[model samples]
Target: MKVNFKLACPLLLAATSAFAGGNNEPTAHRYISERIAQYGEAVERCEKIAASRPLPDESVIEQLRDYSIDDVRIFLITRSSLVSEICEKPELTELAYAIGVLEGADISGTPKEIVQNIKQLVFGEATWGLKKKYLELPVSVQNILKKTDYFDKPFDDIAILNAIENAKKP
Candidate 1:
């Protein structure tokens, strides 16, 4: 059977969530919750900034987290929701999406695909300006970018944005 990887990814994530305790773990989401708590201030700060300053590329910054693959998935899910209820804009959420994409590509994808993905992300993921805004990204998103290595090179939002806007993708 030919499985659709895109559709299967969410199903796989659901299965992973369901079996979160299959390994005799004490808590499936305790770490996640604690991380949110740990970075609570930073996250709120970022959200506040995003709300007060909706532009993505402005010279500013807030929000936070230390995480794993599963954590990124959770962040993607939850942060997406947060844009509607907690924040006025989706810059932080979009950053989460970018991190998720880059992380997934890092795990399994080609350079060409990642190039295209990065290009796409820069387009709608935020306001067009990348200089000041990229510098002001939330602590959590920055950490993820640093962690998600592309071709063994760390993912830099400014560099990727510049590549997409000025130079050839990748």
Candidate 2:
């Protein structure tokens, strides 16, 4: 018998949720809760992106390099609904986060915290020590770092400091 991986993914996630600990709830309840938490995180990210000031039509057009003014305006207007859509679809979290970064969202955490969170989201919790993995980060993250101003300092210096600061956080 052939197993369908797409159908099995949710079942595997639900089964794993039962052994994740920290609660005595039934397996189904725990699975639901885990999914809800994931959705909540995704929504929070989208909300942060939506809260950023809308880029001027000219700026958006320039930054996008391809989109027309009308398309940019539509994209900006529809951003608010992204939170609800992301919340309902946890699988889109990575794409949502990437878009938020590109859109210059005001992430709630400090730079160090934000980097750590991104690292965890992209590479999993096991990949500690940003210095070691700096070059290994996804292209999206590298692009964001390049776009971010670090007061003329080298990216490595800023990345190291952020890593140290992240380690100091509780």
Candidate 3:
């Protein structure tokens, strides 16, 4: 019993020391919230600059670069004529969102795959359609999709489909 008690004392000490260090690390939600707050501040700064000076697209892009909204960087591109070019392809948004998900630390591959699975949602009728119908729109979504290599070729249609199926499950 004395030997057992001596062994238990070290284990208890180790556990207490571990718990003392555990609370020092920031939680996942806190990290994400901090990143979002930074992005929001950058967006607000971009909006202010745009409001103050009616700059051309190049200038606007440059201004956005001056602020560090790294996550929404593509949206800055999308909002420009670049988007007109980008939306011509169906997959740009899908690929971009996928890449964003992959790059973000908090997001899992499943959620990123889920974002990719919603390809049709991103293209909307404004862009994707039959080639003839697509051309009839101001721009074609296919062109945008092609430009971004949205699916990154060798495609993962099954993975995407499975992701969608899982999402539908209650």
Candidate 4:
């Protein structure tokens, strides 16, 4: 009995000291409210970012750089002439979303949005399509996409797939 009590005292003291430090975790209500507040702040920031951004397709052509929205509508003839030169719908409907993302991104933007958009598209689309399509796209289309303002440098299949996998971690 004496030996058992001696060992248990030290063990109990260690646990007591740890308990005395108090739990770093918050209550369930506190955690939820904090997360909600964070989400609200994030939405506000994203709204501001989305507002300042242009429609993106306007920058595809060099000569049209100076044109405003009205200029494009009034001066530019039928269909803007750059659409067919860039992309087309995918063969499978399941792949359409990814194709559309690449096409939308194929227009124009900063390298940051381009990279992040590509990362997210590949990530999010895989959840729906159940497969990744970046590498499956034709080489020619890939080349055209590569030249677009959307495709950032180091746009490789491995990198994109890696991003998708990493995003799944807790």
Candidate 5:
């Protein structure tokens, strides 16, 4: 039987809430959380600056292009509802969704299929780590790897919003 790997939107929001607002998970289990908190701030700052500025000229765009993987990581972290009630940025939300897919697939497949599975799960997973591993894949498998994760339930945008809203409640 086929299994659906896609997480419900509410579920993803719940998980992000648990990770960010729950009791501190043991440090061994906290790499993603700590990383999220660190990067979330950076993403917020960048968003503020980018929003206030006029369309960046090519030179500024080039400078933004120099943003590192760490920057991407931070964007995903902050976008996950750790810092706000709603993740309004499509780019940030997409990044979080992709990372969640990769983390899920790594738990259930061969390293190669694991790589492909995640690439398929996230819209742009190939442009990152998968480029180096592309040659080892079969043509048929590559086709399978291009599909999106099937969602049995629609994502709950409000669950994340709720989590953010509840963060400071007594």
Candidate 6:
């Protein structure tokens, strides 16, 4: 017995169409906002865990790491004023900066401006491994890192503020 091919083609197409893009996919703004909220919640959970002991829980670190490089970059750029808070948390800060360096954030502006932004973005000190990773970044990013004086000394809040103020000069 021969099976009819025409009848099967429409059935196959209908089956695939049902699984196509759906309303479940969020809009760009919604997606960004949701990711940011999740990041904030993860940071808060980590902070609470840290407050109860000398170190934060490993699960929180894993949760934070779940966010993609783009998620971290968007978080940093949108919530820039929270840099100090992010820096104070070593695990979160490291992950955020590492993602930024790895993803090649557009470190534009003059040396001082770039330095000031880096200072704000990375308020906490980077580990030797992270610094090595930063060194391995593209020349454009490396040049920004070098000009930021990241290796000159440990991360100093006062120094960062001073640099930011100095950058505003004509």
TM-score of 2: 0.26
Displacement of the residue 27 alpha carbon in candidate 4, Å: 1.3
lDDT (tens digit, per residue) of candidate 5 on 33-79: 33333334444554454334333234423332344433422332332
lDDT of each: 0.34, 0.36, 0.33, 0.32, 0.34, 0.34
List TM-score per model, in order.
0.20, 0.26, 0.25, 0.25, 0.26, 0.23
Which segments of candidate 3 are over 4 A away from where they belong?
Answer: 1-26, 55-170
lDDT of candidate 2 over 84-110, digit per residue (tens): 343445545543454345335343222
- Please write out the lDDT profile of model 1 over residues 1-170, one tens digit for every residue: 01122233344334434433433232422332232233333344544444343222221111112333334333333333333223323443443454454445423223223324433433344423333343455566546435432212111223323323342224
Per-residue lDDT, model 2, residue 43, is: 47
Worst 10 residues of 6 by lDDT: 1-10
Angstrom error of the Cα, residue 97, model 3: value is 11
Worst 10 residues of 1 by lDDT: 56-65
Candidate 5 TM-score, C-alpha based: 0.26
lDDT by residue (tens digit), candidate 6, 1-170 = 00111233234334433333334322322332233334444445543533343212334333323444434333322222233244335544453554355235443323223234333433334333334454454454323323333322222323333333354458
What RMSD does each model have against the real structure? 18.0, 18.6, 21.7, 24.5, 18.4, 22.0
Per-residue alpha-carbon lDDT of candidate 4 for residues 1-170, written as tens digits (9 for 90 to 100): 11222343344334433222223212322322233234334333433443344433434433233333333332222121122111211212223343344445432222222324333432354333322233343444334344455332112222332333354457
Winner on TM-score (3 vs 5) = 5
Q: How far out, in Å, is residue 69 in model 2?
A: 16
lDDT of candidate 6 vs native?
0.34
Candidate with the larger lDDT of 2 and 5: 2
Off by over 4 Å in 1: 1-15, 33-45, 53-170
